[model samples]
Target: MNVRWHNGPMRLLAPLRSGATYRGWVWLILGGALMMPFMLVGAIVYNWFHPEAGFEGALHPAVFAAVIPLTAAVSLLLPDREVERTAARRLLGAEFASPADDGTWNSRWRTGCWFTLHAVVGGALSGVTLGLVPFCAYLLIQGARAVLDMAPTGAYVGWLPDWGLLTGPGLLLALVYLVAAAAAGMRALAPGLLGQGAADRLAASRAETARLAARNRIARELHDSVGHALSVVVVQSEAASRLIEADPVFAARAMAAVGETARGALAELDAVIGALREDRDDARGPQKDLADLASLAAESGVEVDLRVTGDLASVGRLTSREAYRIVQEALTNVLRHADEPRASVLVDAGEEVAVAVASPAARRPRPRPGGRGLIGIAERAAVLGGTAEADWTAPTAAAPGTWTVRVALPKGTA
Candidate 1:
């Protein structure tokens, strides 16, 4: 282990370096100001028990001295501790390990215990500092007079420390250490009184996880819904351009389909954005399911063969939504990346719903390891206790090399 020079006198001088001394001064002054009312009340109570006063309820002087300061100190404990904790953070640079809130009365009572200890220690330090002032003043006068002569009527000098050459330097050093120790003592209790425990940390972690999950869900919704819409708009616009002069009526129909698709896409986008607003739970997702496959097939610019083999209505809402998204994403991929725009979708609904989309692969590129599309497909399936797979295979003479995405989700998941 390596030892550093700062651990030497720097440890003693730590308060001065970090401005803790200044903070301690502020804390002391603030605490004293707040304690004044309590102290005055205690004084009045003590005097109310005085012999000079004609009141029948009189207490002994010894009891008054013992009880008065303790009563004042206890009365101001909570607020005083809060002041000290703030000073530790601002002035002494205390770093908290975890969060603490407006805690319970039990925690406040614990803080009061800490404050009582502080009062006792701090009161003694204040008394020492006060006593030093008179001593220092007396020493200065004795040093200046130079002659150890008695007063005109006196035979001996008053009770003063035997003057030595190092006395001044020694007294100054003691004062410095007294202030430093007081500041250190206050900072030492900060973590015990102000830090959070294990339960608080766990709650904070859970909240953070919930927030991240909601953000991811919104991102996935936008990507699946809006991306599919944009892909439809692109393909329909291209098809319309090729057919407009040769078949005006069919071209006009395609353009109209584009407008409808755009409107639905905008609504889906609005729904997703609205979910992020204050009334999130009231915001509904875009209504979609395996039954929409026929309309989805119609919107595609190229040929689409969509087949359904099982009872679609038996599928619950969440599974149907996932199935719709899977096909939408697959068709979007076909339009965006495939050399040929034609594709096939198969829905086999049973105890588990299986969905598949196949299209000719793009000319040059293949799926990479971390494409968001494939990752999202896998995530959707996994969320419903299912699985997704994507692959590209060698070309067949009958058609071409194809890219396929498949997902299987358990039935009745909502």
Candidate 2:
């Protein structure tokens, strides 16, 4: 490995001051601690079977070997990989793509392997840390006595050969480096064993795409159904208020139309919400198709000259529904933004279904850019392998001219 150090001694000793180093140490320490109960039980059982071997036998390699499989089994079977991942992310600083737990055999096996590695390595490092500190202290004391020509105080120091004063500091420095290396190794291993794999990432991506698609579908439904109803209501209510006294019969008819439009909008809204709740598979009633275009124009509360040609019944259900929505959105745009609330609609069902709506453009102000209704029309057509375009026609400096929307969709088999 090519290592880069910027500040020499300070850079070399940076891990000692870092909070991540201590947190990593705590994570390893917890792993060793978790294995203690199993090891203790194994030791107790070993002592019971062989009383002649005594307590010293409990510390034998056999006791540790038995506990390893037990810890591995527990880690594998427990449905707590999420918990492990959380701890690893917070304490050991492992970066995971997703925190969701995918209960797969491969995931469990990886968790088991990680558990084994953690327990074994942690226990060994803990033992080394415990032994090295006091040993380094002893070496420091003994080296100081030799350098000062002072007598050694402890009997344990009498057997060792005299060494220079630098031995203690050298060994202490080695211990620091050892701890830093162990922490680095644990961090490096965590992401692979505990983090999300290829399959998990792919699954997450597919789910996100599905969610976005559903949301877009709901938006289009609301914009078409509710928007058209509200536009009709606004126009009828305004007309009813104006003619209520002079033309009682006509005003009553307009008010009735307003009431009918509101009820229809409410029903459509309920269906949309019911489908969102997944209360029933058929919560949403049968979708509107191209056959409903005449009724839509009649109830639009505007003078709409609608023309239809060719065989409408031959259009497929999917294409018909999209074509209907495209027309509905176009009429809604005319009702809301046109200077005159009158439009001409044409539906040509030939090799491909063609729909067009034209109306006098608003003269006082132009429609804002990036309106959702127009975008939705284009999207609906594009989804059915079709095209949609809207622009001003016959414009001049004095007049804004006619605003027209045109859409064409492939006529699939019924």
Which one wins on TM-score?
2
Query: What TM-score would you give candidate 2 relative to the actual structure?
Result: 0.76
The C-alpha TM-scores of every prediction are 0.74, 0.76
RMSD of 2: 5.8
Give residue 187's error in model 1 in angstroms.
4.2
Per residue, candidate 2 scores C-alpha lDDT tens digits across 1-414 of 134444676787788788887787777777777767777888888888887877754467788788888888877886666776787789878776543565787788887788877787776666566677787778778878887888877756653414635766677677666666776787787777877766777888999999888889888899899989999999999999999999999999999999989998998898889867866756567888999988888888878999999999999989998998888888888888888889999999999999989898654335587679888998998888899998777768886678889999999879
Off by over 4 Å in 1: 1-18, 28-121, 133-192, 283-286, 300-302, 362-371
Off by over 4 Å in 2: 1-14, 17-19, 30-87, 93-109, 116-120, 143-149, 153-177, 362-370, 395-401
lDDT of 1 by residue, 1-414 (tens): 135665777776665565567666555545444444444555567677674654322323343345445744464445444554665577656666534554555456556655554554454455455567566656655644544553322232443433522454468567756676676776777676665545567778898999888788888888888888888888788878999999999889889989988998888988877778845555675478888889888875557988999889889888898888878877877788788888888899887899889887745356566557877888889988899998778776776777888899988843
Kindly give the stretch of ten consecutive residues in candidate 2 with the minimal lDDT sum: 156-165
lDDT of each: 0.69, 0.81
TM-score of 1: 0.74
